[model samples]
Target: MLLLLIGFGSDSNKGNKSTKLTVNETFVTNDKGVATISGKTSPDYGVNIDNAKQTAADSDGKFSFEYNLKGNSKKSLRLEVSKDYDDNTKKSKLIYVKPSKKFLANRESLAQESSRAAVASKSQRKAASESSESQKKAESEKAKVESEQASDITRLSEKPTDEQSAILTQLANQTFSKKYPYKGSKIHTILGNIQPWTKDGNVWFAKYEATIANAFNAKRDATLEIRITPLSRDSGNVSFEDY
Candidate 1:
């Protein structure tokens, strides 16, 4: 602390060779918080706080503001400074008005804790994934003993398995063979392609069946899509819903 004070004193005695005006913070605490802008400059230097607001500067470039939290609060603070013979003014960094305690040690500790927490969370997620893989392997081994993978794949991939499709084709052939036996109605559409939901030796076929009696109004007409989708991979079950 003594060394720092001595160094600060030494810096004060140094000749003013810079005209840059800087504030302590880019953000302020309350709606109305003073910004202590202290810098080194010549004796006669002009510092502008706002765009054109009146400013006060001491012998050096040191300046301050006793701002108030007005109803129409300022979103940011713009500070600028200019010296004699200098054509342009140097603007300071945009000061965002926000709540800040200026606790350097606390901020550093919080950053460190956040990094540690992120590492710990990653480790926890890795452990959880490894545990899941182990459980999946165990379940696979047990399933191999009860059911054959080849048989399940063969039955699942069978084509033309829709209940409504088979029923409609069968009925159509029967009607054509009995009616003219030479001319038949064109099979244009199917309303619902009912599917069979099989599980635990029980086969439940769809109850509704619709045949496009004609091609008129076919685009607007809805077709029933049949599918056998697994409800849950673990349970080995499927449910059928018609739209």
Candidate 2:
């Protein structure tokens, strides 16, 4: 704990003034694996955990704490202390614990760097999995697009029919299709699906349906819809706003 004491004394105009400060050093290492420090002194000091919060010092201005420059603590650390906050003359010299030349000499300790390596490995694994999943989705969407094209040729256009105008105005039931260049591309990549040339003519038709709906709402950028059903097995009608 940080301790504070004020001594009361009388001052004489002709007398000399003497001040003495005895620093009781204690060590607190930061989580970065650097050197421990007594106070918030200069040089560098740290704690064992990856943080820089000040823990209270023990009595007599003495304290002991682990250092952390990083999560690992096997590195050297230095701490400087002075009588005042900015006492250049009272500055302490660098306190070396061990040089890199000494630590790198031990292969067994160097091997512990594997801990950092593990973090890198985890990130790579996640990236690979995501890439694989994306590849699979692309394949699926491509096949679906091809199948959709064959069905789209015989299907009616996305333009609102005379009958739909009354309904469109009443229920705001704007027709949207599962087609677009970017949408087709994304779906083809995400689901690994393809569309045939027959549906190609109507391909732009499906694309326009979604575009028109958004255009009606006066949106400049296009958007896609996705559905997330936890238990349902069958494909449900996905609304463009479902996402």
Candidate 3:
């Protein structure tokens, strides 16, 4: 009877050992501070982490749980595994919980990229605004200069002096040469007509009928208008019309 009792006690101890819980040491968390705890225990055993609801181990004795560590100050978690058959509970080694190094690095990089994108967006908007203002100012100045030029052209001029007439004739000949570049082309004469002369703040205007001959010596009559800026005698506009 004594040997049988000892053997029974040994078998009871073996049964208790079979129900003990085991856990893997690898614990991981993300940048958002969610932690994963996983381990092994007797098949169908109830497993719980801290105050979380219990879950049953799988047929393979594997169990896993996720816990939000966002506001939790503790660096480790207590895991409990139990089996109803034995009415016993087992505690696992403390599972260390912390953000993974890779998670932290990725989060920091994302933040920096977001900051740089914001700055670049602001700079682009500023540059576009300044460019628009500059364009408007340039257009305004151009319109003002054009208005002044038109007013000058409408101002009356005294009768052309001999010197001015000579300048006008020379300009007409040069214009004819450029327009009809064939070597033999020439301007025969320039004759004054009504509304023939005018002057402006910066330029003189003359109109005349011109007789020209082309390279083939075919003569044609046309009206010509000439503008001369006395300050730069060679720089002005010349046009021919009324052929």
Q: What is the model-wide C-alpha lDDT for candidate 3?
A: 0.63
Tens-digit lDDT track of model 3 for 69-130:
65434466666666653444544445667777766776688779999999999999999999
Question: What digit string (tens of lDDT, one per residue) describes model 1 on residues 34-83?
Answer: 43344443345665556564455667656655554323233465555566
Give TM per candidate. Answer: 0.28, 0.23, 0.35
Clashing residue pairs in all predictions, respectively, total 0, 55, 0
**CA RMSD, predictions in order:** 18.2, 23.2, 15.0
Cα lDDT of all candidates, in order? 0.44, 0.35, 0.63
Ranking by TM-score: 3, 1, 2
CA lDDT for candidate 1: 0.44
Candidate 1 segments exceeding 4 Å error: 1-35, 39-62, 65-80, 83-102, 148-243
Best by TM-score: 3
lDDT of 1 at 2: 50
Number of the predicted model whose lDDT against the real structure is largest: 3
